[model samples]
Target: MKKPLVIAATLAVVLSLGLAACGGDDSSEETLSNSELIAQADQICTDYNEQLDTMNEEAALDENSSRQEIATYISDDLVPLYQEQVDELRSLNPNEEDAAAYNDIVDTLESELQVVEDDPEAAIDAEDP
Candidate 1:
């Protein structure tokens, strides 16, 4: 994928994962303070970034890999990773103040991920208007 789109997709994954890691249980009346939520979310992103960095490093080692191979890897691996993040985010049941923004992010990421899953090569090759 183009650098910008790749960055955007990565960011979407980070944010979604952060939101997903927050919490999912509805029985608890306790809610995290905004600062606490931010801290937790940041930690989740940090961990995910580290994992992604490793994956990128491995991909980079294969100098002879074709665009199709890269796209296939992304579709097979990253798309499901993004989807897992989305699923986790949905389970969070975020508060009203953050729900709208979180939902928007999740929706955009899910749609983009779907496009990648359907046709990874086209997604990588697509140009911005």
Candidate 2:
């Protein structure tokens, strides 16, 4: 009887551990702690800086490759990244201003990206340089 009880206890422990693992890190844009969401917002700012650098360097390259690469980078990387970040940021509490700023960044950047994609020459002409 003692052996059976010990085995059951061990099984319960193992099951609990497995469940904990399955819960995973629920810290995306929509499900995160406050500090974690703030950290994620800061990370998105960093990513924006990186993308700016990439865009500047790409613009100077004078090749179709640069624009193509940037398009892929924007769609494959930046879009999803900021989307997730904004969702995560919105999940934060008592940070309405910061969340609004994050959402605005996401919207503005996405809109600009669509325009650039659809009308590269017009977008370039309209840009500040």
Candidate 3:
């Protein structure tokens, strides 16, 4: 269960960063350098990862916590956080050079988040080793 949760969290960071790396103003008149785009994206991922790490640590401190409780947290808390990140990523207009890759990552993250939102319990179950 923890494995799956960790994997999902890691993927969220990776995908968010990937999305960020390509983000910029959509205007043809304005474009960010690749380094600038990556830096911005990296910051978003850093913040997101920090929050996720804190949540995981807090959850770990509760040895008596039930699977249901974890599931509830993931669904009610974590999913919303991921959604916010995704929303932020979507708002960024990628540079022309990175648009295709950026859009692909954004789509993938949206799909992954939808699955977790729709059936958080199943997601938890799938993590069982």
Question: Can you give the TM-score per candidate against the true fold?
Answer: 0.64, 0.37, 0.74
Q: How high is the CA lDDT of each candidate model?
A: 0.56, 0.40, 0.66
* Candidate 3 local lDDT, 74-115, one digit each (tens): 787788878877776666666778767877887888887888
Q: Quick one: best lDDT, which candidate?
A: 3
In candidate 2, how many Å is residue 13 off? 52
Least accurate 10 contiguous residues by lDDT in model 2: 16-25
TM-score preference between candidates 2 and 3, better one = 3
Query: What are the runs in model 2 whose C-alpha is more than 4 Å off?
Result: 1-39, 51-105
Best TM-score among the predictions, by candidate number: 3
Q: How accurate is candidate 2 locally (lDDT)?
A: 0.40
Residue 47 in candidate 3 has what lDDT?
Answer: 75
Backbone clashes, each candidate: 0, 2, 1
Query: What digit string (tens of lDDT, one per residue) describes model 1 on residues 1-129?
Result: 365336335545534543543433222355444454455455555565676666666656253557767676677666666676556544444565665665676677577678777876765566543
- Pairs that clash in candidate 2: 29-87, 29-88
Model 1, position 11: C-alpha lDDT score: 40
